[model samples]
Target: MTLSPLTSPLLEGVTHGFFTRAGGASTGIYEGLNCGTGSSDQREVVAMNRARVADIMGVEALAGVHQVHSATAIVVEDVAARPRADALVTDRPGVALTILTADCQPVLFADRAAGVIGAAHAGWKGALDGVLEATLDAMEGLGADRGRVRAVIGPSISQRAYEVGQEFLDRFLDAESDNGRFFANGVDGKYQFDLTGFGLARLRAAGVAEAEWTGHCTYTDAERFYSYRRATHRGEADYGRLIAAIRL
Candidate 1:
């Protein structure tokens, strides 16, 4: 199968993509390009899928981290392990930085003037924990001005479909009352939190000049994307992850 990479016109001229879960070698539940090594997908299929992504990104090697949903970010310097971090920033050219997402947001960043690029996996927990802000800070540490950075969020579960319990709302509101703006009344007493909107808010609050989401919903779209919520809703064994990448 071939690859499908969703891109943005605002980020034109920069090497970046929001890849879909289409055209891969895996079978069954992981039927597409499941690039997540942390997933239960077969190792061989995952390797091939990542290699394909590396080739498409025009990088001999793609660098990624173990994504612990923390506020931590790493300055890429040929690290040996995929460190326990949620974000990565690099000024070095040819290093394709990638992030895996299954309903969570895979965000890419670029400061064209500074020749710096960043990749992050931002779930609700990570966003609440300030992972996006951490990423921007790490990029600025490498000479990137936050105001000059452009951040784009890839496919993630949209608010209308992201039904959460009362506890989730409590966490966000307790952390910051302003975060209550990101939620809407769900079917019952539940609330639907806007993950992408929260992500954009974090980026903008961190002083990023431009931040946008591709306006894609992973849970609602089955043919082109993978969703952890969808898998659980259907009682499926496992779910694959989608990969988004960018390189300088």
Candidate 2:
């Protein structure tokens, strides 16, 4: 199968993509392009999938982090180092930074004029801790202007499918009282949290030039995406990860 990656018009002229699980060499639960080296999928098959992505991105190798769900964003100078972080940024022309996620926000950032690109895996924990802002800070260190940075959040769990407890709602409310706006009433004392909306709010507040979500829900769309929550609901042993990448 040919790789079908979703592109953002806001990131036009940049070599970047939000790759779906449509094409690759995995089977069983990971039937499509499961690029996660950390997954239970066969290492060689995952490598083949990643190679396909790298080929399409016009790079020899893809650079990514270990994704520990932290706010730390590091500057990538080595493709082999899988540091324990959640975001990566680079000014090097050929380096393509990538991030893996199931339902969490996979955000790609680019400041075309400065030739800097960034990729972040922003789960709820990382986002609340400031991964998006940290990415912009890392880009700025590479001479990229935050005002010129354009961020596009790829497919993630939508509010309609993200039900949470009062404690989850309280976490965001505790961060800022205004965060209540991102939640809506759900069944039996639950709240539907808007992950992408919160991500866009954080990016916009961080002063990025433009920020938008692809608006694809991972939980609802089984044919095109992999969702952690959905897998757990079905009692599946593991889930495939979706990859999103950007290059300078």
Candidate 3:
């Protein structure tokens, strides 16, 4: 099967992709394009899948981090052992920065004129902890201007599917009461959190020139995407991971 990677006009001229789970070697619960080495999927199969993604991106290797879901963003100068971080920024020409997500945001960042690019795995913890802003700050250190940076968040769980409790709502509200706007009432004491909306607001607040979500809900779309939540709801053992990448 051929790889089908989604692109954004805001990142024109940058070679980047929000890859779907369309074409890969894994089988069973980890059905298409499972690129996460951390997954319980066969390691060699996961490697082959990542290689396929690198081929489609036209890079020798796709760089990734251990993804601890923190705010740390590291600058990638070469492909050594993957680091323990949630995001990566690179000014190097052929290295592709990649991030894996099942339902969390896989955000790609680029400033074409400055030749800087980044990829971040932003779950709510990472986002609220400032992973998005940290990515831009790291890119700026590599000569990218925040005012010229363009960011696009790839497939993630949407507000309607992201039901949370009052404790979850309190976490964001404690940071800033204005965050209350990002939540809507859910059944019982639960609330629906707008993760994509929160991501965009953070990007805009950080002074990114352009930012937008792909508007695809991973939890709701089982065909083209993988959803950890959906997998758990179905009582599955494990779930596949989707990759998003960007290269200068």
**Per-residue lDDT of model 2, residues 59-135, tens digit only:** 99999999899999999979989999999999999898999999999999999999999999999999999999999
Ranking by TM-score: 2, 3, 1
Expressed as tens digits, the lDDT of each residue in 124-163 for candidate 3 is: 9999999999999999999999999999999999999999
Better of 1 and 3 by TM-score: 3
> Model 3: what TM-score?
0.98
Question: Candidate 2 at residue 11, lDDT?
Answer: 97
1 or 3: which has the higher lDDT?
A: 3
lDDT of each: 0.90, 0.95, 0.93
TM-score for each candidate, following the candidate numbering: 0.97, 0.99, 0.98
Candidate number with the higher lDDT (2 or 3) = 2
Candidate 1 structure lDDT: 0.90
Q: By descending lDDT, how would the candidates be arranged?
A: 2, 3, 1
Clashing pairs in 1: none
